[model samples]
Target: MNWKIGLADNWRRLHTKGTVVLSGGLALVTAFGPAIIDAWNSMPPDLKALLPQGIQRYAALGAFLLILVVRYLAVRRKGGGDGAA
Candidate 1:
């Protein structure tokens, strides 16, 4: 099957009530990505120094993924099988 068709089908199948909110969040993130990066880069040296050198991006990504994993587990515990809650 074509990748585009498969993606569309999977999206339709997986979409839930929270899809709109998720889509909106993604749109906002995409729109503000550059500004967000610029802000991070412009933080005061002392503030940036809080994180270890060369690990800022990885730390941020790990924290974000951890939150997502926790949320996923919470939803599963709540029996939110479709993750709409």
Candidate 2:
């Protein structure tokens, strides 16, 4: 029984998730970016001062990563089991 197939399958899954995250992030930025910028601008000065420019981008990335991780765990719990590998 070859183990390389399992490794390849995992790599493909990770690549797919990464692509989904990036594309989803781009779509989110295109859709709600104005609202995000407005919200940031409206934040209290002291609070805003705690985070530097591009914080929104970082927040978006963090949110997406959290989402992906949760979804992956949920699927794993549901017995997806390496997805046919």
Candidate 3:
């Protein structure tokens, strides 16, 4: 009974949560991006050599976050600046 509605609601909640989480992450990266990049670069030679995958993942995370925020803002602007959507 009403499982479809429940599923839609769950998906909506997940998407909204992702938007908020990614927005915050994007803001953080914008604020302290240099430090983050610096720390990543400062990893020891062996560690950097060993953890290329992890390093790439975090860099991707940062880029993904940046894209999310830009998309969100673009959508919001398109909807209108009346604080509607």
lDDT of 2 by residue, 1-85 (tens): 7554345455756745645666676687769878977987898999988887987678778877876675565332355575642
The estimated TM-scores of all candidates read 0.41, 0.42, 0.40
Candidate 1, residues 1-85, lDDT tens digits: the string is 6554335455764544244445556568768889988998899999988878878577557656755664455333366576655
Worst 10 residues of 2 by lDDT: 71-80
Alpha carbon lDDT of each predicted model = 0.64, 0.68, 0.68
RMSD of 1: 6.0
Over the stretch 3-79, how does candidate 3's per-residue lDDT look in tens digits? 44345455755555646667677678679978988997887888777765666678767788777676666343556
- Backbone clash pairs for candidate 2 read none
Candidate 2 Cα deviation (angstroms), residue 61:
9.4
Cα error, residue 36 of model 1, in Å, equals 0.7
Supply candidate 3's per-residue lDDT for 3. Answer: 46
Which candidate achieves the best TM-score against the true structure?
2
Model 3 is weakest, by summed lDDT over 10 consecutive residues, at 1-10
Give residue 4's error in model 3 in angstroms: 34
Task: For candidate 2, give the lDDT.
Answer: 0.68
